[model samples]
Target chain A: MTFVFRNNTIERFFSDGEYAFSGYDDYGAVPEAERYIWWYQVPVKYNQEQLITEVESYLRRLQWAVSQVGQAPFLILSLELLYDAGVVRGDRRLVNAIDAFNQGAWQLAAEHTNVSVVDFGAFLKQYPAAEWVDWKFYFLSQMIVSPRLAGAFGQWLQTQERALAFRRKKCLVLDLDNTLWGGVLGEDGIAGIRIDGDYPGKAFRYWQEAIRELAHAGVILALCSKNNEADVKELFAAREMPLKWEDFACMRINWSDKAANIRSIAEDLNIGLDSMVFVDDNPAERELIRQQLPMVAVPEWPAMPYLLPAFYDRLVKDYFAVYALTDEDLKKTEQYRQNAGRAQAQAAFTDMDDFLRSLEMELTISPATEVTLPRIAQMTQKTNQFNLTTHRYTVDDIQRMLDHGARIWTLAVKDRFGDNGITGLIIVTDCGAVDTMLLSCRVLGKGIEHEFLKYVLGQLKASGLEEVHALYIPTEKNRQVQDFYDKNGFLCTREEQGRKAYRLSLADWDEKRNTIYKIV
Target chain B: MEQKVLMVLRRVFKDATIDETCSQSNCKAWDSMNHLNLVVELEMEFGISLEPEEIARMVDYAAVVEIVKTKI
Candidate 1:
């Protein structure tokens, strides 16, 4: 569950699912199930001294929350001093206080792996400071932000959530010629290219510098250019070029169709085609890729080289801006390489079931304890694609469930090559209501979640439960699981507006757990 | 032109009951920050720039319409 630490009355702005709060800025005992958020809006009071003190205290509270959360991610929206400075005179004190708060937040996030700092200043810049707060809502409900900008604010917050969840594009495939340099590579040979000097070339140089920063931030850069391989090699060898060819992780320099080339790149990298961004100067190439590989993102090329900076900004904002990088993220390029080798090895198997059976998968199912509680709560919050009931729960709520006699089981799956730890969870109420069942997409195609659920059902039957009832709550991302319960031999009792309710008699239930997977 | 300006203000303030009497002193929603937003929206909507002096003088709805009319 998500917990919001709000200073102003923002009940109308945010949804009811988020726990709204006010009063003293402190993180005492953060409940194990709740993901903490620091959402304090800049106070509009005239007293600069109190504002400075309160801002300093907010940093301390955030630091304390980070220490308490341990491995769980804590989202901290950067403080925005949202008031008209013209009314308050030249008060450098407020400016200094806001700088200190933002600096403290960035420093803490750098030190703590779990803490992520989102730039609230960027959103604040969309409107003038004087127009940010409407006094009518402030006087009536103490709303910090103007209600008129609520729709824009909600969209920005959704982008923030995507960043926090690590749902970002993995690779960027760039085109050469006018896209990278100032002119076409074929028409203007290595010496004739305008990459270093004068108007349009200067802009191209700046764009290259920005892309180099993206590469430094761990986005795998690739080349998918239709150019002479030998000439491109010479260009890379030249010392005058601003960007080196070594910056790219992979290159596909050939005369072949881009759609075929992108497909080959996906095979070479072993990453999903959906996680690629293709940038090309020619609209024809971009359109071809878009038509053939629709999952791949094709950003429109700027008409002028000078527009590259703005284009780069849009690229980072839309695709590559992640909240924080994990250890897995740093080694993602290597992991993709390994997956390529695994794909080749799996070709020897005769059938799909044979390929899965040969993996010798092991699943560990156990009661939810302190170690697994946070992941269980997080799974409930973020697992939209494969969730059965879509019932979101907080750490505090899960702990309360345990205290009130709810049995929660988490499944950790491991195959021969790697261990996808704690990928599925099932929360069964004592009253025989299966409230939630969800699995991470990493282990979905293997049918591990189904086997895991069947094992739990078998155990529940042995423990004196006569019947088990379950529900399917449909969401935009969870259409794949609509017939999940029906497939498991449960009789559907109700159906309405994409939601389905089902019940199963334990006596008549089939306890057919897959023999390939060993339940520990 | 006056009706268009009023429509923008009403939408920004989220108060359908707003009229020409709305001003910085009388309308609570016309606070400092929102005052700036109203100015920006008006500038973009009417395609005109209001000087700092004229912006400050536009305290009430009647004054806003007068100042906006001169610029447009």
Candidate 2:
């Protein structure tokens, strides 16, 4: 259950009983809860001086409460003045005091990953300022928020909580004709298409700018249009639009079924179909995708061009808002583009060994440190395809394992194309049993997993370890790695219900590493 | 109209055994918070507003129906 620290009656807003509240204006002696919430509104007072003092005390109490909660999530709602009783005009003291508290909350969120600030002003903006509080209800029940808006408040709070968890969609696939520009490329031709000069073109220009910003924020862009490839390429070169040819990680500019094209784009980018959002101006195309691929999200397109900006806002709020961005997220688009580059480079070489050696791959393996711990935890949570014994972990769980003397190493793979940061992880118990092993799909085609395993086992043998144990737990997406241990010369000791256990003797294991890549 | 009140009471109190005889002194679920919720739901259900005096006097189901009948 979540424990809430509030100064007013907010139990009506969070009516699900999954929450426990503190006493009126209580911040002392916090009870143990799975998570915590702070929703302190500005206490109504006639004197401006007294109100400022009360609002100022909230920041200190919040800091103490945050410190007491340790690593649990603390959601703090910014203080909003529901009923301002100030009579003097041009009063700046109260507003400035409220601003200071909100600013301090934001600073705490920046310092700690577990602390997040929810914008309470966004919800209050929906209603008139006069209707924020009902005097009768306020006197009767001490509720600062109107009981009439309880339903809307509950829904808004749930969306904010979900956004805090950050399960944002990964890719945005676009349709070309009328979706990105005013006119079709196949019919209007390069010069005839309106993209830069008229009323409708200006609207499309703004929409393209919004989509480009989404790409820089780490949402992969793709194209699925029925226009000829040459025509689209010519238009991209001729028009001075916000999007370019290189912005899209993959494109299917052929006369093919849109569902099949979208599926191909997902495969090309190495992402799941569910993590994609498709935008198209044509309703028929949108309906086809909705029916054929139910997992992909198809948002309703606005009929008029001017409504595109509002539609973009709804898309971000619904699908792409995260609590915060990591360095890994900021570099996602570049990494996906590099994967496409490596694919083309593979097609040019006849020998697999030659391709591996010519890439100048470098693998750096190190024990988990403070700098790489968050990335390591994130990889364990997200990687699915190449994982053996699929086990998800958070930062706190990994820190506990490290305290117990478990050996956890992270592998950073860099090649001529780009740097895929901290893409592989191995967690081994102190007794030399492999608890978890996973590699991101971006760096999978070059035989790095086997080389990583051999290197780790060689280290164990050098330290006078005798045997190593491993297991392959079956999952829906990890079926390809069922015999991974068996292929690496591990003896399968037990096999039951799609689960396999293997043991390897370090004394007799081959310690040969692939000479193609440099290991440090 | 009485059955509508009974249904709203059942939903807000989360108790199916509630009938017209349920009152604040006897019912365990009709506490202060649920009392506020009931007022909000009644105003929304019957499109009427309740004064503070009427809400205070609505300690029993009969009083609740009587106040709502005068407003609508």
Candidate 3:
């Protein structure tokens, strides 16, 4: 179950079953839950001293909660000062206090691994102040947000939950012509395009800037336009505009069906079509893509060019909301590019194994200590695709395991190009049971996780462990890891409730690590 | 006009089966929280601003339609 610590009337906006409490000023026990949400809005009162004291107390309360609930993910929504303080005296102090509070939340998140800070200010920017607060509702209840926005807010909150679940789309497939700019690139020459100068052009410029920020936030931007590649390329070269051609990782600029172009873009980016959002101004193109590829999200474009900001908000809220960024997510584009490079380099070698060996991969395995415990626990929580058993563990639970004589090993892989830090972990109980074994999806295709496991098995065998038992628990997000134990040579002993248990004789196990990965 | 107000309320409250008997005091879901939601929905649906007194007195389904009708 999820719990929310709120200062406003957001209880009605979220899922019905979730629990919420009043603001930090209210003294109450933090309820028992798997996750916690900090949804406190910036107070509307302009009392500078009172606001500062309240803000400080809020931080203290959050700190107390964090100390109490160790290792459980605490999702924090950033504070946004929504009200216009023009009517009140000493407004700057209130603004400063709110700013300090937001910065503190970010700092706290950075310090604590389980804390995730989401920007609520970005969501608040969607509506004007007049529409944001309704006097009638404010008088009825202390609810700061107007009721009229409940539908949009509910949809936005759902997107945020999806984002928290780590289910954001991988690529954004964009359309050119009036979609990318104010005018068509083919009809209006590179200089004649409305991407930099006046009213509509400035709006498009703002839109491009927003898209650029999305790209910076690790969303892979791609282009799918029915125009000459050279023309689009030239427009990007013209220094008048803020966005460039090279800003996009992939492009499908031929006069082909948008569905086919989208498929090609996904293939080029090495992501599924379901992980793509197609944006275009033309209804026909959007409808065609929608019919052909139902998995790919196609948001309706606003009829007026001036509504691009709103359109951008809809796009981000619906598709690109993320709880937090992982190290793998930050280097996703680079990793995809590396995979392409590896594919090209593979043809030069005589055999597949020879090519793999030539990569000079190194696997570093050690028992998870104080430094690597967070990554280990995160793997147990988030590693779905390559997990042997989908066992979610909190930091406190992992600490308890260590206290109970469980051996947990975390593995880090490094190649010539880069280091994939603490990508996999295995927890083994004293009774020869593998409690959890999982690897991050980024380093899966490289065969590093297998070698890491084999090295651990060799160590266990040397320590006189004759047999090991393992389990594969099934979850909606972890279907990809169902046959993981079988692939690793463990014999299935039982299957129940879609979960499979496996046993392996370590004495008879193959102790050979892959020649590709050098174990040190 | 009353029918239009009821239609708007039903749609906004997301209860197609709602009737005149439904009100804030009687319906469990139509408390202060949903009252705020109902006000927002009513305002947006009818394109009118309701005063605080009218919003406070909109306790039942009939009263909801009456207050909304006065505003329109």
Q: Model 1, A1-520: lDDT tens per residue?
A: 7666667765445543656454434355666646767787877776667767776677777667677767777778888877744345676776777788888888887777677788888887988877788765565456778766766777898787776666589899999888888877788777778887788888888988898888767788778998888889888897366678777766789999989988877876657899999999899999998899999999999888888999999899888986456676776554454443345446677787888788778999999999888999999998998999888999999999999999999999877756767889999998988999999876667788789889999989999899999999888899999999998889999999988888999987767677888889
Looking at candidate 3 chain A, the ten consecutive residues that score lowest on lDDT are A336-345
User: What C-alpha lDDT, on a 0 to 100 scale, does residue B21 get in candidate 3?
Assistant: 83
Instruction: Summarize candidate 3's per-residue lDDT along A94-164 as a digit string, tens digits.
Output: 66767887788888887887887877777778877677776666667877776667667768766766676
TM-score of 1: 0.54
Residue B30 displacement (Å), model 3: 15
Predicted candidate 2 versus true structure: per-residue lDDT over A1-520, tens digit per residue: 9999999998889987599999999877999999999999898789899989989889999999999999999999999988878998899899999999999998889789899999999999999988789877899999989999899998999988888786589999999889999887877789877677777999999999999999988899999999889889988998899999999988888998999999978877778999999999999999999999999999999989989999999899888876567777788888887886777577689999998888899999998998888998899899999999989999999999989878898899999988887889999988889999999888897899999888888888898889999999999999988978987899999999999998999988776788998998
- Of models 2 and 3, which has the larger TM-score? 2
Question: Each candidate: what lDDT?
Answer: 0.80, 0.90, 0.78
TM-score of each: 0.54, 0.80, 0.61
lDDT measured at residue A269 in model 2 versus the true structure, 0 to 100: 79
Question: Could you give the interface RMSD of each candidate, to one decimal?
Answer: 9.5, 0.7, 1.9
| Regions of model 1 farther than 4 Å from truth | A15-19, A22-37, A65-74, A84-93, A106-116, A135-141, A162-166, A324-520, B1-72
Query: Model 2: residues >4 Å from true position, as ranges?
Result: A14-19, A32-37, A63-76, A103-119, A155-166, A344-412, A421-440, A453-482, A491-520, B1-30, B34-72
Docking class of 3: medium
Candidate 3 colliding pairs? none
Whose DockQ is greatest here?
Answer: 2
